[model samples]
Target: MARDRRPPGRRGLPGLGKLFDMVDFMYLSGWQKFFERRLQRYGSTVFTTPLFTKTVVATDHKAISALFDTIPFIQDYGFGSAVPPKPLVGDVAPSVFETGVLHDNPKAFYFSLLRHRATSLPAVFEEVLREYEVRWASRGRFAWRDEIETFTMDFVLRWILELKFDTAKVRLIYNNIFTNHLWRVARFFPWTRYSRSLRYYGEFVRAIEEASSFEAIMEIARTFGISDRAYVAKQIAFLTGMNSYLGLQNLFKSIVGELSSRADIRSDLDLQLRDAAPGALFSPRVRAVDEFVMEVLRQHPPVFFIFGRAIEDVVLESASGSFDIAKGERLMGVIPFAHDDPEAFPDPASFQPERFQDDEARAKLIWPRGIQERPADTADRTCPGKDVALLLAHAFCTALVTRYQWTVVKPITWDKHRYSLNVAAPMGELEVAGFTIRDERAGRPV
Candidate 1:
């Protein structure tokens, strides 16, 4: 097929409208309507101005999938620091990009490590129980949002770091990295939280500097062909700073929001989990928990769209038509759009875990890089922690409902007509506020 030789016309408004769209996008609110309106007016695939730049946004799954799978796209970090500064006190070796040939590629390293660790989820469930036991015992009243955030950080640290260092300090450093740092310079300010984070950051690096302290993780790294102790230490620090803490925290909160509104689904989930044995909760054969998790994810995928820059000239074909994509153009695979496509998802607005019971239906869902069923190891861009994140959510949910009873202090109402910017769910409601829990065993109602 011949390419569309003509230059594409402008999409939506010019000048300030592009800046406005960028602001709405950054806030994760108000931008969906803007995107939807443009897609309706133009086509499934159109070049729209976002962030003061012309970006091709594809709503059709075929176009998005091709953008992800067949066409090559380079990661664009935008203006933010590529990564929060590597521990300032380390050996100061250049990153893999500078080192050129990496024996143990970091991407492959994490993929292999997560895959191997996923097998031990049963033990991870026990850890979840212990963490909750500590929280439930001393608490009289607590905010659901705050508790979930704390729990998420604690869980991720223990699971990934194995608690070899001070958990509190590490959490602080990571929090500062995300919230306080600008151009990665906050560490230089005295008396501020960011400077304090810098101090702990060095201590945290020194602790993991040996790398051999983590025997199991080191073994996997070795198998992947990386044996440098300092290199492993640097990777550990990078992993620690990751904001998966924010991702899982938001995810669980959304789950609670859904549970608050739907008494029927919540009741069923509670009943299924309450009677199941500890081992049963981690069983691959268990469908109830899996179904619930899948549905929530399908409804509220954490990533709205996978963004990348095209590396070559390409033609993207969708239900609407084939469109020419020039080399060096920025492309966004709109995950929410694909998830909501009516042709693929009948009654796409409704929350129904039953849809995922069919393998075919499950295959249609996309989170970031690819469909849920594909192995993360197979793709360079696939989230290595996808399986682990899901497993952690499952274990935590199991612990949350079975061990205690909770009340939604504020009634939850769903607006079926609206949509979420963070989550693609139709309700447009993603917050979990005013929820409280009580210890059922002690007969205490707080």
Candidate 2:
């Protein structure tokens, strides 16, 4: 990683260097704003920055596409923040990447568990959402984002693992997490999030390890060298609890918030569901809901930031100049930035699922193969659980907006600097006055 081959990139906010950049990126929505701006000025190429030990920032389509090819090896550095997680791979679960050294990808087998329950997914989701709706109805007003995270996590754990979690217990963990995050900044949030998720997921790991039907799942985890009880506990908890929690929370927020704000969309969606008949709330034939979900996924991607560290020198050519990224250099692919790339997704910020409703929409796509792509099951590289996630997402929306009418008491306002705490306070609990919904029967703004 010689300095001469590396393109010129800012180290930080002068004097502060990486520290300043970390705060801006992890805390404030710094890089999200800068990725597009920098690409316009710098063109598509890798540039070394103090942000990571050695780093490459690629904002172009080709450069970004090459990154997934390096997956399960180019380990992520939590998107190269100066205050990286102390545990290194503290993301809710222990996957091949989190095990320190990469092995044959375990995700393929890990996702098989979901396949067994695929046929019953919609019914399971309907059950969970119906129960959760009862809870929401009981409460006059509550933090919708906060409660939604809990309900989704509970549903995911139960749906994926067949564990019956007490809703009160789920709410307790979510509440404590929110409390810890409010007192901290960007760097501190991961610690709070992990500790809380770890505490509960620890029990989950043990339960599964002891279960008669779960030895096969444990064997699969063992392939990744997650055999030790302690490691198993963390890994299982992460996989079952934390890993999917973030995505579920984001998807829940985007869909619910959009439906809350857009009466017309809700009306149209409800009409479709009614026409869909009973038990077909999530039917693919329901184009309005399917396209709406796609739009939300594109605009508010579950994993908003992507970071991959190079284990060997990789060559990447750009409009500016070609650069051979030295081993150990970190590469970043801000997914949201790529989605917002004007050339790829014209009117990137607009809510237009129709952009992907036809052949022209396919041309607008920048990512051809990824669970991160529009259609969930299109590619091997796509998230294995994508279809299931979409199914649950549709079930969630149908249970809410499509099944009944509602009113948004107070619209949510997102604080860009909400950072790590975004999970607990996805909309910043302080300002995130959960859209106080009026009683469904009343259908009047409170």
Per-residue error at 144 for model 1, in Å? 2.3
Native-vs-model 1 lDDT?
0.62
TM-score of each: 0.79, 0.75
Tens-digit per-residue lDDT, 1-446, candidate 2? 43436665775554577665566566554545545445555554455455534456766555666666544335444322333232322333345333323322456445655666577667777787777766766665576766777777777767666677654544444334423433335334555554555455445556656655466666666755555555554555545554566566777787877777677778777666766654455665576677787777666666654566677776665545667776776776656656666666777867786776766555434322342445433123345566667766777777676444445566655444444434212254322323333344333434
Angstrom error at residue 393, model 2: 1.3
Best TM-score goes to which candidate? 1
Worst ten in a row by lDDT for model 1: 95-104
Candidate 1 lDDT, 223-313, residue by residue in tens? 7678977677666675654435656766777676677677788768766665555324455434777777787787777776677677788
Candidate 1 Cα outliers beyond 4 Å, as residue runs: 4-20, 27-29, 40-45, 50-53, 71-104, 115-120, 164-188, 210-212, 273-279, 411-446
Q: List the residue pairs that clash in candidate 1.
A: none
Evaluate all candidate structures by whole-model CA lDDT and list the values in order: 0.62, 0.57
CA error at residue 403 for candidate 2, angstroms: 0.9
